[model samples]
Target chain A: MSPRLYVDFVRRLGNMTLQVRLAIDTEILVLFGPSGAGKTQTLQAIAGLATPDSGLISLDDTIFFQRVPGKPVINLPARRRRIGYVFQQYALFPHMNALENVAFPLAGRRDARERAMELLERMHLAYLAHRMPHELSGGQQQRVAIARALATEPRVLLFDESFSALDRPIRERLHEEIRALQAEHRLIVVYVTHNLDDAFAVGHRLAVIRDGRIEQIGRIDDVFIRPANQRVLDILGIPNAIRARVVEVGPSGALLDWDGVALEAPLLNAPPGAQVMAYIRPEDIRLIYPDRPLSRIVGTNHLDATVVERRMGRHVHRLRVALPDGRQIEAVYPASSYATMSLAPGERVRLALRKESIVVIAVHSDPPPIEEEPRLDRAKCADGCPKSDPAPVSPSPS
Target chain B: MNWPAFWLSLQVTAVASVIILVIGLACALLLVRVHFPLKILVETAIMLPLVLPPSVIGYYLLLAFGRGSPLFEWFNLRILFTWQAAVAASVVVGLPLMVQSSRAALANVDPVLENAARTLGASEVRIFWRITLPLARRGILAGMILGSARALGEFGATLMITGNIPGRTQTLPVAIYDAVQAQRYADAHLMVLVMTALAFAGLLLARQLEPPTPGRRADQSAKASV
Candidate 1:
């Protein structure tokens, strides 16, 4: 079957230019970006609320917008596009009660009232049906807006940061509710959000947008685990991006030289003597105390490090460890293991860097010097270790 | 008391208010939401009557609708000294109030709500009628009331175009002029008192219809919940 929606457009507003091309099927595609990244603009173009300067937007077989140079343009009005959009502010009709607002689009239909009531019932908002928008709470108003959007039975639904206004608990509940509704109705949903947690919780696929361009689009896991570039990695908040030099390239993998220590990472396209940024999540690094014997995990790189800081998380303790070669890395330890080990600042530990978890981001020659401090400074340091220089590197075994 | 003049003024005001309401709403909607070339010029023209002297407007109306003008030459019709001329003068005088208030009201209606309505499959007409019009009802009503009050008290324009014919076209304001000229102080005082009461009532109603202050609305909603 054809994709549910396809959009390729280029629009210029003032000095900012928004260019995007995307196709979505019957799944929730979350447009993830910071504010002013053109996420909301994309939704507007698809719903026909904002016109694009050039390009085509099609839903299934119906073309909603098409404009080519020296050709007749076809731009359908928003009313005829049959796309439902829930605004960030809810946009419920203040002049109408909840029921009347939901029934508004259903006007001229035979059973608009009954259908509107049914939708309210499904939203569990029947009790507030007679209440005006101001009388309803934020969450209730959002539900009413959703019901109103669905009243027309649109081909696709667009949500522009709809849950950002609610508290955490309410937002989560609404996310789950919307997810269930999308699945039940088999809707083509495009949700926009700047919050990573919201995107992960609601999106089947993720599209990372920056500066009006979609940098990457893929399954949530793939985008999170194997980002498209260093920018994507940084946006995803993947910890432990270390600068390294490619010293040896073998068929199996490449050996990266960080300071004086050699680490093995998945083979990349870079030749020998090329600079690359290696990324690994802090949770993927396994911590072993100096007193305990290291596990016999194969194809793993191990380094002796001293804990400079430890931060207590909800379920894990984040430790900022300094390698013997002066390189700093972060690792997360389970609360149970941290309690059992009784680890503290100035304590020595062994860190196992999993080979499969290492991602090499290619870099051109003449990379900028690395900053000594790790990005996450939440961990309070107990030891008086020099912030600029954690340790001095000794001669390598090689 | 000139009952015929009072009745004539009421009829003229009633007809003028209806005409002003329709045209004013259309102009306000266009000014607030639609973009076009020379928009500022059109807005300025609509507001010209508000700042111009009433005698100036009356002079223009006399030149346009008087005998031998287009109304007489092209249509072979003469409205001078007629109640229809009085109605025309009232409509022109009252229009600025209607257009200004309605424009402000329509501008205040959130564009997001209209866009939301559009995405929900509402046609432009339906969105205007069902969403924009209802949301701006208070301001529109205030505009109509103010415009009607303005039409009722219109004297210079009415006298210039319709002439001061007691039973045929003399309105309350014109009748008051005639009474004062005739040294009928008691009759002039009664007419002034009645006009004052009506204008005062309209102003009070418009004030009541104004959207509640933001803080007051918040407090009202809070108290409503309690």
Candidate 2:
């Protein structure tokens, strides 16, 4: 099928306004972002639930909204559009049975009951046809929602934090179910999620949104590997960032004086005398002993550091290394490597970064803002004084 | 028994209750769903009839339909002092009750249900009819019954709009007033008995829709919330 699903619009939430220019017809485009990112806002705009201030939204050849020099009218109510929106809450009608809720749109029509029963059967909710939404489990409700949306066979499907409500195992199984459903229906799915694992699992393409803009939109692996800026590198959970300067530039790649390690980074277009910060994913960095050949052969951007902290996660050990310059960088090694290295906190080690793995960004950065002011506390005289108990006071006359 | 006045009162209350129910529900839907520039002002306006005294409400209706008024020509359309005038009075008194109860009912509905209904391809009108109207049926019933009871209790507004014209304007309330003035104690007592029975029935209906108090049953709340 031709690429007909396209969304070009601008919408606002709070003080932040999101402007999205996108075109996707047959792919599962997962909007990846932190909470309060414009991921869900963009989907709401496409669904016509949230109106854009000015812009055009076109799905296929039909124009849903437009703002131009001569023409100014640009609004469409949600019903006029044929988007199947699955709310974060399944939102099943409480009064109706599972079958009746599934067949609700078909109500007031001939054969509505039979059609509803058919839909419920597909969702494996036929047995629960007489049951209300509260009677069903979280996973069952999700299936019912999916079945209801597909009842009309809509062109595009929008899921806003849909699986975030379910239990973990159920969430995983639902992903497979959704994928199978998407393949069978060939429907264009625009899923908005804050979970990285879910985005990578189901998304054909990932759009990372930050501060009301599309920071980067590309294939999932590409965005994860090469984030465009420091903000994205930090947002995507990259652990190690080191300050460096450009020493050599080339057409093939540039040599970075990354903390005096002469790192052969495959990024360029920077003048030789520029100060940069290289971002590296922790998984790429290897913790090697001083005697290793790889540690000895390092020329560009290598750090002789001592491990200051070790954290054991589900699948890997997170080691925090403090370089000689008093800057810390983190690296993740397989759990198996833990036995060989005999690594522990405060042990000295050598760290290495792959030439292509280091993403060098320009120097200026803004620190996160503090929302609340700091208050000074006086000495406390009682037990449970400072930790558990707050400041005790006599009642002021009301 | 004064069957004519009894039947006339029932008819006026039923017809007026129907009109108030429809208009009040429409206003409630507007207040709940649509966002207008003067939303607060419109809400205050819809509820204005509630707080206004029956005498003040009658005075305003009389002015609009009274002779020597601009709209008096339309009064020549046979509304003033007719049985239709009693229905009009009922409409005035019944409006606030209808609007308030319907708004409460509509407000209780989960927005998710409406959104889900829309995405499932049901039109806006269909969602209201099938999903909203049905779910709020008990509230709607209570609102109408309250309006009916209010119309039954109407005295000042009815007297001002439609003077006591027996078999036409002499509803049970109006008839009772006329009986007491003429020193017909037995007649007034009989009308009182009938009015009390009807009032009790309305109270029964209103009680049926008592809106289930908070935290009693989750199922009841879900049903009420649509």
Candidate 3:
């Protein structure tokens, strides 16, 4: 059986409380969340850098931390935990050369040089071994940090927004490198990032955190395609999350009244008259030319929409289209398609919301308004309609 | 010049700076790294010498190590009015500068870097020697310069505890006072020149011992990499 790390802890972080519970085996799990959402704190607790008020953290049989009320606390020091951590800034020893930094953990060994050289070579940093941290570029420094972290051959590795500092090209390359390293070492990796793209690119599983709580955790596809609640949908950065009401339910799926425009969704667990939220990926919503044949339509749910706005992106075109009820839905199409269609604002178009792709999330009673609603509305719509997505979104899944 | 006083002053300054460096570094590490109750009070006490009058420090030292004190009675240790007392006085007046400068240097070192070392399986002691010490070397050397200068010129405190005894307890500053009081103008002038020359040489030597600034090396490598 693969070794698993179990963490269940609560901590008070200066006017906020952090509570997290999760289990991770030998796989890459990305703690995805916004800034200050307690993702880093969770990693610190596991690494024994930050002690929790009460809880248990163990890897396989070795207990790293355990605090039961009215009982002895078993808290291990950070050095004894043997957990590798790659800090956000890399934090390479500025005084040491790349080789010395990688060899730090093996300080008293007879063959520390050879072992350090092997690790540096594995990171493709052998030629730059003598270079100091600030002398190297950001990407090089990050590689040295990783090599140093892995020098002890730790059971688990944690990265705290480690890749968020690199350029896209370098980041993508390192993502592939890290995945390869994980497979070779069979190390359980936990990466924290606020970027959806980085999370998807590097993670096998996704755990979305909000306000120090784990909002959702599952396989990447499971969590992204079938979020557990409306809160999960919001944290997932889905722009077209619409509050809808279930009008009918059947074995196939649920018929949802999305702002009076009826739409079909995959199998839902909610009953009729229950309020729910429908999330649709911009790429999943296809733009149908006005004169296209009826038999050529791809989805069951069709709605007439007027293009309210069109924004050009690098590889895709974002279009905000309005339904008959004045609610806006943002959709994206490949730039190649946009070159041919050249759809403009105020142009009437037909939109097909793929039933299989629409994630219907059950809404909690007295739900708080989404955080970006006010800013999103003030940016696009002047009438105070709650619309999401002022920030640039991920490119369409190609 | 009083050759005996010159030799005695050199010995005292050297001994005192060495002790100051060790104790000041320990105190600095405690202030920067460890957490305990009454930490602020401890820091304030360490810094007392920086603000207190030299005579006041001499009074406290007398109470602790003078005749009839516990140290003198129980251990039969007689430190008062000896060259060791001069060394002790120099250390007391020079320690605050060393601690203050070293604390600033150590505090400037990023805690994140130390945490990174801890995760890499390094003990606290190893992290200090390998990571913290090397990074803060320049600032610490600067502190040494300040401390040694203060020790070399220490007069008020040295006079209070170890009275001016030529060829025994009198340091160069006290030697100069003796020369001027006896109206030996030429002798005082020569000794003052020697004092100024020694201070300047010490400053130059510290600068020479320091490694090249990382900023310059980094800039060169950055260009090379580009």
Candidate 4:
């Protein structure tokens, strides 16, 4: 059986109390949050660098840290934990060359040097084994640090924003490499990154942490498409969170009454007259082309809107549109489409919102945002939304 | 030129410098890495000799190691008016320089690197030996050189505690004072020149161990030419 890392702890840090609980298996679980969200602290706790006030942390059958009021405290020292951690700064020993650094933890082993060289080769850093940390580039140094961390054959590998400092291409390549490494070793990995792209590129599951607490944890697509609470929605930075009420529900779907505008959304378990927040991404709002056939845009909630404002982004143009009710909604169009359509302020256009694109989150209950059932109304959504693909309404870049 | 005094000063300073390095580093490590109550009080006590007059320090050491003090009464260490007393005075005067410099050097070593070593499965002893010591070597060396220089030039404290016993307790500085008192201008001038030259050499060595600055990189690279 594959190993599992279970962490449940509460630690008071000055004014902030970090109470975290997680169970990670062989797959990578990305801890996603803003800065100071206790993601690094969680990693520290797991690595045995930080002791918790009172809780139990275990990996498989081994107890890593345990502190109960009446029981004998069992806090393992960091050196004994056998967990690998790659810090943001790499923290390579400035004086030691790459080979020596990797060989440091292998002191008692007879084949320490050979094993370290092999680890370097595994990281594709064999040629730079003699180089000091300052002589290597950031990514090269990072790889050396990884090689050093792997020398001990740790049970779990924790990376704290390890790729945020690299260029986009290098970062993406490393993301792929880490995924391959995790699979090859079958090691449980926990990655902490505040960057959304980093989280998506490397994570098999995502845990959204906020204010020292996990707001939601689920498969990446589920959390993005159907956030459990207002906090999770806000952290995802979804641009449109419109106040609405559930007006009607059927096997087909639920009808949401936004400020004087009715929007068709995925089937919700919520009752009618319940206050809800309908979250829609700007890219999800599609502009209906008059020249295209109506069949292509069928089953979408169609609305007449006048462009109140337009702003140019690097690749997309953001159009702030006003419904006949005077309520404004933001939609994004590709620069190519905006240019071809010659869209401008004060121009009247039709917008289409796929029912699957709208996520209706209840304002109250504020329950944990995991284990949400499939909210997709398959019968009505099968044609417009692909079950596996998230953000189905947004056109693929290719 | 008071050759015996010159030799005695070298012996006292060498012995004192070695003791200072060991104790100073231990104190420095404690100050930088440990957390305990009254830490500020300990730090102030260590630094007191740096600012206090050598005579006042001598007075305190006298009482502590004097006739009725615990060190003398219990251990019966009759070090007064001996070369050992001169060594003690040199150590007392030189220790503050060593501790302050070593503390700064140890503090400058990034704690993050130590934590990284800890996570990498290195014990505290290994981390100190492999990581902390090497990284802080330059500053610590500089501190040792400075402390040695201070010990070599020690006159006031040695005079108060050991008295000016020619060919025994009289260090170079004290010997120079004795020569000038007897109106031996030539002997005083020669001893003074020797002391100044030794101090200058020590200071230059200490300066060489200083961390390189941006403006000095070109100079260092030229010197290294590696």
Candidate 5:
């Protein structure tokens, strides 16, 4: 089946050049990225609000923008695109009340009021039909904006961080509402958000954008489990990455020498003597007190470490452990587990690195350095420690 | 009281204000929305009458519409020293006020709302009529009132172009000048009082019609609706 939306565009905006290509089916495709990553620019190009320097954007065979190297370009105006867009600010007409704003797109058609009322009802805002934009709260205004967009029954829906302006409770509620609406209508949605939780909550698939380029695109679980590169892993907040040298290769797996410690990981596609980076999720690392019997630790990949710090998170306790070789790794344990184990700083512990959970990624040649160090309070591990340390161990796949 | 001059001034001001409103609104919309080469030049030209002396503007108007000029030679229309000349002078002098306020009001409107309207299938014309025009109505109305007040008090330009022809082209301010020259102190006082009262009323009306300040708009709306 043909994809619902196909977009390939290159546009120069000020000092940045936005170049993106995407094909989306009828699902919520969340364009996830930091600010100024061109997610909104891509949406504007599809909605016909901004023109691309050169490229084609088509929705279900209808070309919204098309320009070849030597051919005449066909660019449809925004009014003709039949795409619904909810602006980041909600952008409801201040002069019009709720009902009138929703009815605006349906003007010159029959049953405009009835249809508008139906949409307002669907949004649970019928009682506010007569309230002006200023009279309504932020969430209510956003709901009206959504109702207005739906009044046109557009072919595609584009939301540019529509919930970023609302409170958390309201934002969460709207996320569920929009998700249900997408499922019920089978609508193609391209949602742009900088918040990772928002992306995970509303997106069936996530597209990681950076510097006007799509770094990776996949199902949420796939992208979270196996990020495309270090950038993707960093953006996803994965905490544990260790640089290791391949010491030996076997049919089943490869043995890696991490700081002179022999570690066995799942087989990766690399030469036996090549350097690679191994990534491990903090939650996957099992921690045991030294009092526990060594026989209970079945894995050969275990490390004796001393807890350097303990940070309490909303749902988990983060333990920063310094390895025998002075390398630091982060581990996450549920609050209950940390409480039951009575873990504290300065205590010795055994960390079991699960072989299956190790992801080996080939180190690219001098990958671009992260511009801003990830915030320590939010970072799961000292994953960024490699940047400060010399002889950076390249993380490899398991 | 120079009742004829009083009636004529009112007529001239009303006609000039209506003309200024239409032209000023169109110019303001273009100035606020469209971008083109020499845009700053066009804006500076629109504002020239506001800074130039009234007699200078009248002198230029006289050269353009005077006898033997293109207007009279081509169209065989005699405008100088007539009521039409007075109206023309008033329009020229009042245009800047109309355009300035209207442009400011249009510029203050949220452009995102207009873009939203476009994506919602609104044609450009419909979006302006339904969204932009209504939102900017307060400022445009103030512009019209200010324009009218400026037109009513026009003297030097009217006197230069129309020559203060008594009972014919003399506006209130021109009549006041004529009364003072004739040493008719009572007549001058009456005309001055009437002009002052009318100008004051126009200014007061404009002030009342001005849109609420940005921070106060929500509070004002809540109070008004309640």
Candidate 6:
């Protein structure tokens, strides 16, 4: 089936300060950005709540809005455009009960009561029909809003931070419900959100907007692994960045020289002897046994490193390791990895990195970190038992 | 001063208040919801009676309704120095109060709810009746109560426009004036007590219907309703 919505437009927000230029062809296009990036404005424009100065908005061959010079004719009113909008606050009528809110659109229409009941049933809110908006829980109110929006059987759906008010567990379930509904309906959803994690969770195609301009947009994996620029990298919270030089030009790919140690990096079209900042995800850097059979000195210098600081992350342990020049780099090891490794603070270990995962940001750089001594390493197991702490500087040569 | 004059005053006030509630509500809807040129001017013109002396309004009504008058010729009905003319005067005085308060309340309903309703395939008229009107109902009710109170207290314009023709045009206020002229203050006191009770009740009801917020109130109420 053809795409329901094809929006190729640039809209200037009120007073022409912020501009939103978007081009997308997805079942669900997630508009992700910080506040004032025009995310909600974009949703409003799509749902026909806000008018754009000039743009062609087409949904399945219907022209909703278009501004042509004197003969402008491509404008359709919001009611004529079959788009359902679920507001952030639910926007349910406080005076009406849950069923009435869901059935609000059906009023004066034939079989309105039956249709409203059916919609409530679909949203699993049939039993709470007579409950007012305040009486229902936050999650139930949201469902009523969803049902009301879908009651009209609109071709397009728009959301303005619909799950922002709910707690985590409820938010997760709502996301799942929305996902399930999208699967059933060939819906063109224009969703707005400020949370990157939420975007990553629900977004099949992610659009990162900064200061009203979409910095980058692509599939989730591509955007996460190969961000368009430094700003995109920062949005994903990947913090381990080091400035490097091309130490050696191998037949396979370019070797990134960090300080005096060479690291393998996936290169594309870059000539030998180039300077770049390498972005390494903490998860990919595997601390391994230096002499293990599976281990190879893939880079010029596989450095011996001592564990310094260890902190708890979401379901994992974050460890900071010290290199030779008093610089620390953070890496994550699962709780299972720490349990099996029997590693303690200040212990020496080898770090392994796959070539494909290391993203090279083509930019100017200072130098790779070189930590002389381990500073904040936790001298214990995952159980928090004390082990021998390492001295300031461990002079281990492989 | 007589029973018929007293009854005429009560009847005219009741009919005038009802007419004001309907027409004033329509005016309020136009002012608050629909956009047009001279909106502010029209709004000011409608609210002009609130500040104008009752005798001034009475003079205009007299010119409009008296025998061989242009307004009398246009309406083709007997109104001058009659109960209907008294009703016209009361409506003229009471209208501004109703329209002003109703407009304020309707302006406060949420535009989002009406838009949402429209998106659900409701016609413009349907949106007004179903979404906007119900949401702004409290405000409209308040305006009606206020109009009723104003109509009850209406005196100078009503007295001048519809002259004191006993049992025909003479209303409670006029009857009170005649009772005082005849030195029947005790009889006037009963009418005064009734009028006072009605005015107080209307004001109390208006206060009850007044919106919680100064400008905006409920969500659907802020939308267009005309």
lDDT of each: 0.79, 0.72, 0.80, 0.81, 0.80, 0.70
For residues A207-300, could you state the per-residue lDDT of candidate 2 as single tens digits? 8888788888876645655678878876766566566677777877777776556777765655676655556656666655555555332334
Candidate 5 segments whose C-alpha is farther than 4 A from its true place = A240-303, A306-398, B211-226
Where model 2 places Cα greater than 4 Å from the true spot, the runs are A1-4, A68-77, A105-116, A237-304, A307-398, B1-4, B33-42, B178-197, B210-226
Candidate 3 stretches greater than 4 Å from native: A69-72, A241-303, A306-398, B201-226
Arranged by DockQ, best first: 3, 5, 1, 4, 2, 6
Please write out the lDDT profile of model 1 over residues B131-223, one tens digit for every residue: 888878888899999989998989887888887888998999999999999999999999899999999999999889976521122222111
Q: Write down the RMSD of candidate 3 (Cα, Å).
A: 11.7
In order, the candidates keep a fraction of the true contacts of 0.63, 0.48, 0.65, 0.58, 0.65, 0.42
Question: Any runs in candidate 6 off by more than 4 Å, and if so which?
Answer: A10-12, A17-26, A69-72, A107-110, A210-212, A230-398, B36-38, B66-70, B73-78, B212-226
Cα deviation of A355 in candidate 5 (Å)? 23
Tell me, by lDDT, which candidate is best. Answer: 4
Quality class of the docking in candidate 5, CAPRI style: acceptable
Winner by DockQ between candidate 6 and candidate 5: 5
RMSD of each: 12.9, 14.6, 11.7, 10.7, 12.0, 13.0
Candidate 2 clashing pairs, residues 3+ apart or interchain:
A261-A300, A261-A301, A261-A302, A262-A300, A262-A301, A263-A300, A263-A301
As for candidate 1, its interface RMSD to one decimal place is 7.5
In model 3, pairs of residues that clash are none
TM, every model = 0.75, 0.70, 0.75, 0.78, 0.76, 0.72
Superposed Cα deviation of residue B224, candidate 4 (Å): 36
How many residue pairs clash in each candidate at the backbone level? 0, 7, 0, 0, 14, 16
What's the lDDT for candidate 4? 0.81
lDDT for model 5, on a 0 to 1 scale?
0.80
How many backbone collisions does model 4 have?
A: 0
Instruction: Give per-residue lDDT, candidate 1, residue B51.
Output: 81
DockQ of each candidate, alpha-carbon based: 0.27, 0.24, 0.29, 0.25, 0.28, 0.20
Candidate 1: where is the Cα deviation over 4 Å? A69-72, A237-398, B213-226
Better candidate by TM-score, 5 or 6 = 5
